[model samples]
Structure formats: C-alpha cells, structure tokens
Target: MKIETQCLHEGYEPGNGEPRALPIYQSTTFTYDSTEHIGKLFDLAAEGHMYSRISNPTVDCVERKIAALEGGVGALLTSSGQAATLIAVLNICSAGDHIIASSSIYGGTFNLLDVTLRRYGIECSFIDPENGDAAIEALFRANTKLVFGETIANPAITVFDIERFAKLAHRNGVPLVVDNTFATPVLCRPFEFGADIVIHSTTKYMDGHAVQIGGVIVDSGNFCWTAERFPGLTEPDSSYHGVAYTRDFGRAAYITKARVQLMRDLGASPTAMGAFLLNLGLETLPLRMERHCANAERIAAYLSTHQKVEFVKYPKLPGNAYYERAMKYLPLGASGVIAFSIRGGRERAVRFMDALTLASNVVHVADIRTCVLHPASATHRQMTDAQLEAAGITPGLIRLSVGLEHIDDILADIAQALEQA
Candidate 1:
C-alpha cells in the first residue's frame, strides 16, 4: 500500500466483532496463563508484552505502523524525542565512544550531545554540514560509532545531504542516523538514501494536532554489526540473561537491544493512550503534510519578497542555499517551518512577532495552528555565541511554523505584523 493508505490500515486491523477504531490497551501489565510462557517473554524468546515499562499492545501497534512507514525492520516508541535520541546513541555507544553530528540540529539535542552526554564520558564532535567531505571526514576517529544529522535541520531550514553523509559514514564503517522530525517519512525516507536508522519527534508532524508528546526510533536493519565494531549487539547482554542480540534477533538486533535494554532500564516508554492519539494523527499525516507544504511555500514566497525581510531560508524557495538538495530529498515539500531574519535585527524581529495577532508566539512548531519563535532568546539561548554562529543562527532569525490555516489569513497577519515592525 502507498503511504497514505498505510497510515490508516498498516497498524491495526479489527476482526469479525471487534471495534473498528484502534482500542487502547491501557493496562500496565499483560497476563499469561503459563509460567513457562512468561519466562519466554522475559528471556526474549517470545513475542509478547509482560510489562508496560517494556511495551503495550496499543503502543506496539503504533510502533509497527511507524516502522512500516519508514521501511524499518522494527521501531520503539518513547516518552519524548530526547529519550529516543539518548537511547539510540547509548544502545550502540559507550563511555569512550565518539559521535559526529551536524552542528545545525535542534538546540535541546545539541545540549544533550555537547553537555549531558559528555558528562557520561561520551564525546561528540559537531561539524558544519556544508564544510565539505574532507572537513567532516577529519572529525571521525577510530572511536566514532555513528554519523548523525537531521533531514531538515530544526529552525536553520538547511537540508542535510543524506547520501553524501551516508557514504562518508559507510566508508568509515559507521551507520548514519537521521532525525526525520521536520521531513517526516511523508516527505523523505532517509533509509532509501543510505541512512541506517531514522528517528522522529511524533510531537511534530506525526501528532499534527499537538495533543501529545512522543518519539520513535526506527531501525532500517541495513547496517552490518560485528563484534569488532558493536560488541553491545554481538556480545552477550548479561542484563538479558546472556543473550547476544545480533545472534538472536539478526536484522532486528539494534532495535531489540534498544527496547529490552535501554528503554527497559530508562523507562521512557509511551503510554497506550498516547499511542492511540498518535495513531489518529498518523492516519491524516499525508493529508496534513500536503496542506502544510502548500501553506509554507506560499508563506516563504511572501516573506522572501517582503521589504522588512532581510533574508528567507526555505528549501523549497528558488535560489535558497538548500533548494537543490531539498528538491532531491524533500521533493514532496519542505514541511511547514520557515526561517527568515528581519531587516533591523533582533529588535525588529521581536516587534514583528509581538505585533502578530493571528500567529501565536509559542515555543512550539509544526502544530496545526500557526506559531512563531525567536530561537536565539528561546530555544538556542543556552548556546554560546560561537555555537549559535556555527548553527547558522543570527540575532534577527525568526522561525515561522506555517500551519494548515488558510494562506490568505496567515499572509494577512504577517503583512500587518511586518507593517508594524
């Protein structure tokens, strides 16, 4: 089935007398008749959920749907996108390991890698995506485990060259993990372009209604894990009674280890209710994304031509830095977010946002309702001047998340706001 149909029909199917809508299995534990069967589950020899801390029926259905959507062997849902990223890294990396990530990622993610993960002895090197192959390649060390980047970088509005980075990572014997939050599967499937793993903050496009916060990590099952490079997968996991993941689960080793080990211990699993809501959102992702892209395209064009605008950074716009790359990767659309700087810098930017009557000045993005944010003072406030510069951020930068609202109204609001600025 195509993605549109898959969104609705992939996850759950009701039989004979069963309800048509996906049911919420809200209980925390599953019951089994035999003690031996429960042991099989505990030993990773069975396909059943024993505890909600590990998995649930509703959440499992959503995971399967997301995995199918991304063409992955399996997926694990988490409480939030942060938990998914942390678990994805820790599942394959250790204390002395190194990570290479694009400098233009979400600010919270940058802080996670640059500060929190460093405290645990795992070092990360941030490289500019446009620094060319040689510069990015120089950051890789023998200790490097994976290459990380975003499909459409948060707020920066730059498109990541997935195939280019994937080749770089593969040449160095590392897998490439991409954050697909902005360019969700509906827009771009990183796996088709050589990415080994894909992740998304369902709180964005997948949960278009902005009703829930969730994340998922999807394993492409394409990376070849060996004892030499990934002992965590090839070696015995004492936590699971000495089960070697690669040997036991084969293509699903990485995700299985993530679920049974990291998610199991960290307890970042999503609730069944959350999964149900996410499924509802997924059913209309293709439709919503279509509107989002159309609306954003119009908004970007208006901003680019506006007299008060210093510059516009929408990949779909002609002559934009990432226009060619976006055409290749995000042909369907560049999602809803647009980044443009005001002419008079930070003060004018704030004035414009404050003057807006329709668009909410919220700290959120990709919601069904239009919103805007000043990243430098809000999301990227924690970053140093040098870090902000490296991230392609300026004092006047504004992230406008174009929603599904009528284009005329959104533009009218922006036009009035710009006049006030």
Candidate 2:
C-alpha cells in the first residue's frame, strides 16, 4: 500500500465482525490461565503484553503504525517526547559515556543533554550543524555512543544534513539518532537517509488536533552493536535472565532493549486512550501534511516580502539557506513551521504576537489551529544568550506555526498584527 493507504490500514486490521476502527484496550492487565505463560513474558521469551507499563494493545498498534511509516524494524511509544529522547539515549548509553548533538535542537532537548544528563556524568558536545564534516568529526570522543540531530530544527527551521551527518557518525562507529518532530514521516523519513534511529514528538504534527501528548522511537536495525561499544546489547543483561539482546532478538535488539530495559524501569508508557486518540490523528496524517505544506509555503513567501519582517527562514522559500538541503531531504513539504524576526526586538515581537486575533499565542506548535510563539520568552527562555544564538534564536524571532486555516485569513491576521507592532 502507498503511504496514504498505509496511514489508515497499516496498524490495525479488523477481524471478522470486529469494529472497523481500532478498539481501545483500556484494561491494564491481560488474563492468562497458566502461571508458566506469565513467566515467559517476564523472561522476555513471550510475545505478549504482560503489563500496561511495558506495552498495551492500543499503544502497540500505534507504535507499529509509526514504525511502518518510518520504515523502521520496530518502535516504542513513550509518555512524552522527552521520555523518548531520554530512553533513546539511555538505551545505548550509560554514565561516563559521551554524546555528540547538533546545537540547533529543541531547547528542551538541549537542556536534557547539556544540564540534566551532565549531572548523570554523561557529557555531550554540541556542534554547529553548519560546520563542515571535518569540524563535526573532530567532536567525536573515543567514548561517543551516538550522534543526534533534528531533521528540521524547531523555531530555527534549519535543515539538518542527515546523510552527511549519518556518514560522519558511521565513520566514528556510532549510530545517528534524528529527531523527526517537525518533519513527520509524511514529509521525510530519516532512516532512508542513513539514520540508524528515528524519534518523534507525537504531541506535535502526528496528533494534528493537539489532543494528546506522546512520542515514539523507531529503530532502523541497521547499526552493528559491538560488545566494546554497546555491552548492554551484546553482553548478557543480568536483569533479564542473562539475555543478550543482539544474540536473542537480532534485528530487534535496540528497540527490544529500549522497551524491556529502559521503559520497564522508567515506566513512561502512554495510556491506551492516548494511543487511541493518536491513531485517529495518524489516519488523516497524509492529508493533513499536504494541506500544512501548501499553507506554510504561502505564509513564508508573504512574511518574506513584509517590510516589518527582518527575515524569513522557511526552506520552501527560494534562496533560503536551507533550500537545497530541504529539497534533498524533504521533497514533499517542509511541514507547517516558519521562523522570522520582527524589525524591532523582543518588545515589538511580543506586541505582534499579542495583537494577533486569528492565530493563537500558545506554548505549542504544529496544531491544526494556527499559533505563534516567541522563542526567547517562552520555549527557549532558559537558554543563555550564547546557547540561544547557537539555536539560531534572536530576541525578536517568532516561531509561526501555519495551520489548516484559509491562507487569506491567516495573512490578514498577520498584517493586522504587524500594524499593531
């Protein structure tokens, strides 16, 4: 099936007389007549959900759908995108290990790597993605476990060179983990560009209605886990009856370890109802992404020509810094986000956001309803000046999330907001 058809039919197929829609399995525990069967589940020898904390019928379906969409061997759903990132790294990394990440990632994620993870004795080196391969290659330490980047950065709208970075990571014998939140699978699949792992904040574009907050990590099953680099996968896991993941699960080692090990301990599994709502959003993802791209292109063009706008940073715009790379990585659309600054600084930017009547001023992005946010004040506020600059956020920058609303109305609202500013 094509991607559009796969959106609706890939995850859950109705059996005879079953409901056409994916049914929500709300119960946390499944019944088994034999104690030996339950033992098999605890030992990782069974293929069933033993507890909701580890897996669920509804959530498993969504994970499978996303894995299929991303062309991954398997996936694991998490309570939020942060949890997914934490587990994605922790699944392969431990205390004293090192990580290499692009500086242009979401502020929250940057904090996770820079601040919180440092307390855990895991050091991370933030490299400029614009820096050439030689510069990036120099950041890799002997203990580096993985390289991380975002396909399309949040607020910055900078396009990451996925294939270039992937090759660099492969050269260092580390897998490339890409955050594909802004560019959903409908727009770009990082796995096809040599990413070994793909992650998404399902709270954003995937749940188009903004009804639920969720996330997922998809494993490409392409990286080799050497015992020297990833003992957790190649060596015996005493916590799981001495089960060596790569030896036992083969291509599924990464995701399987992520689920049974980190997820089991962290307990960040999504609720069954949350997964149900996410599936509803997934069913219409292809259609929604198409509309989002079309609307965003027009908005970026309009903002670029505006006198009050300092500059527009949407890859769809001609002559944009990331245009060529976007064309190579994201041919369908650049998703429904644009980053631009006002002529004045933060004060006028705030005024513009407040003046907007049609677009919402909220702490979210990629919703069906249009919204705007000032990065320096809201999302990226915790970052220092140097960190903010590294993320490409100016004091006057506004992150506009173009929605499915009619372009004329959206443009009219922006004009009025500019007038007020």
Candidate 3:
C-alpha cells in the first residue's frame, strides 16, 4: 500500500466482532496464564507484555503504525520527545561515550545534551551542519557512538543534508540518528537516505491537535550491531542474563535493547490513552500535511515580498539555501514551520507578534491553530548569546507555524503584522 493508505490502515486489524477504532488498553499490567509464561517474559525468552513501562497493546499499535509510515522495522513510543532522544543515545552510548550533534536543533534538546547528559558523563560535540565533511568528521573519536541531527531543524527551519551526514557516520562505524519531528514522515522519510534510526516528537504534527505529549524512536533495522565497532551489542548483556542482543534479536537489536533495557529502567513509556489519540491523528496526517505545505508555501511567498521582512528561511522557496536538499528529501512539501527576520530587530519583532489578532502567540507548534514564537525570548532563553547565534536564532527572528486555516485569512493576518512592524 502507498503511504496515504498505510497511514490509515497499516497498524491495527480488527476481526469480525472487534471494534474498528483502536481501543485504549489503559491497564498498567497484562495478565498471564502460568508463572512459567510470566518468567519467560522477564527473561526476554519470549515477547509478551508484563508491564506498561515496557509495552502496552494500544501503544504498540501506534508504534507499529509509525514504523510502517517511516518504513522502519520497529518503533518504541516514549513519554515525550526529549525522552526519545535520551533513550536513543543511551541505548548505545554509556557514561564515557560521546555523540556528535548538529548545533541547529531545539533549545531544549541542546540543554539536554550540553548540560544534563554531560552531568551523567556523556559528552557531546556540537558542529554546524553547514560545516563541510571534514569538520563534521573531526568531531568523531573512538568514543563517539552516534551521529545526531534533525531532519528539518526546529525554529531555524534549515534542512539537514542527510546523505552527507549518513555517509560520514557510516565511515566512522556509527549510526546516524535524526530527529524527524518537524518534517513528519509524510514530508521526508530519513531512512530512505541511509539514516539508521529516526526519532519523532509525535506531540507536534502527528498529534496535530496539540492534545498529547509523546515521542517515538523508529529503527530502520539496517545498522548492524554485530559490526566490530559496537562491542556492546555483540557482547553478552549481564542485565538480560548473558543474552547478546545481536545474537538473539538480529535486525531489531537496537530497538529491542531500548525496550528491554532502557525502557525497563528509565520508564519513559507513553500512556495508552495518548497513543490512542496519536493513532487518530496519524489517520489524517497525509491530508493535513498537504494543507500545511500549501499554506506554508503561500505564507513564505508573502513574507518574502513584504516591506518589513528582512529575509525568510523556508526550503520550499526558491533561492533558499536548502531548496535543492528539500527537493531531494521533501519533494512533497517542506513543512508547516517558517523562520523570518523582521526589519527593525527585537522590539519590532515583539510588536509584530503582539499586533497579530488572528494567529496565536503560543508555546507550541504544528497545531490546527496558527501559532508564533520568538525563540530568543521564549524557547531559547536558557541559551546565552553565543548559543543563540549558533542555533541560528536571531533576536529579531520570528518562527511562524502555519496552520490549516484558509490561505486568504492566514495571508491577511501575516500582511497586517508586517505592516505593523
């Protein structure tokens, strides 16, 4: 089936008397017939849910749906987008291990890598995505376990060159992990371009209604953990009774490890109710994405010609740096988010945001209602001046998350805001 069809029908199949809609299996634990059967689950000798922290029926259905949507072998849903990033790295990386990440990413993720994870003895090297191959490769050391970047960076809206990053990572015997939150699977599937693992904050576009907070990590199942570089997977796992993940699980070594080991300990599993809402959102992702792209393209065009606008950064627009890459990766449409600078800097930018009557000034993005945010003041305030500059968030830059509203109304609101600026 095509992607559109998969979005609606791939995950769950109901029998004769079963309900058509995915039901919420909200219980924290599942029952078993015998003590021996339960023992097998705890030993990892068999696959059956014993606790919600590890897995749930409703959440599994959504995970399967997303796995199909992104063309991955398996996926694991987490409590939030941040949790997915943390587990994705921790599954392979240990306290002494390191990661190479693009500087252009969500501010929250930056803090997590730079501060919180560092405290745990996991160090991260931040590099500019625009820095050519040599600079990126230089950051990789023997301790480097993963290469991390976003498919389409949040707030910055710059597109990462996946193929180049993937090649660099593969050469160094590390898997490329991409945050595919902004450019949902409908826009770009990173696995097609050699990405080993794809992660998403389903709280954004996948939920679409801004109702739930959830994240997911999808394994392409292409990275070989038995490769000489990764001794962790090939070696016996003492926690799992000397079972070597690669030997037992084969292609699903990464995700299986994340579930049985990381999720078991960290306990960042999503609620079954949240997964049910996410499933409903996924059903309409293809249609909503088409409208989002169309609306974003129209708004970007209008901003480009506006008198108060200094520049607009959207891959769909011609003359943008990422247009070619976007064409290759996101041929369908770039995404809903767009970044632009208002002519007069910080004060004018704030005024423009305040002047808007139709678009909301909200903390979220990728929702049915159009929303705007000033990263320097709102989201990226935790970062210092240098950090803000590195993330491509200027004092005057404003991020507009285009919604599915009528094109004329959206354009009119933006036009008025520009006039006020």
lDDT of 3 by residue, 1-421 (tens): 9989999998899989999999899899988999999999988998878999999999999999999999999999999999999999898988888999999999999999999999999999999999988888889998899999999998888899999999999999899999999889999999999999999999999999999999999999999764456777888999888989889998999899999999999999899999999999999999999999999999999899988899999999999999999999999999899999998899999999998988999999999789999999998999999989999988899999999999999989988887788
TM-score of each: 0.99, 0.99, 0.98
Alpha-carbon runs more than 4 Å astray in model 3: 226-229
Question: What local distance difference test score does each model get?
Answer: 0.95, 0.94, 0.92
Between prediction 2 and prediction 3, the one with superior lDDT is 2
- The segments of candidate 1 whose C-alpha lies over 4 angstroms from its true place after superposition are none
- lDDT per residue as tens, model 1, 305-405: 88889999999999998999999999999999999999989999999999999999998999999999999999999999999988889999999999988
- Write model 2 residue lDDT over 71-166, tens digit each, in one string: 999999999999999999999988999999999999999999999999998999999999988899889888999999999999899999999999
Which ten residues in a row are the worst by lDDT in model 3?
A: 224-233
Judged by whole-model lDDT over C-alpha atoms, candidate 1 comes out at 0.95
Report the poorest 10 consecutive residues by lDDT, candidate 1.
301-310
Candidate 3 — which pairs collide?
A: none
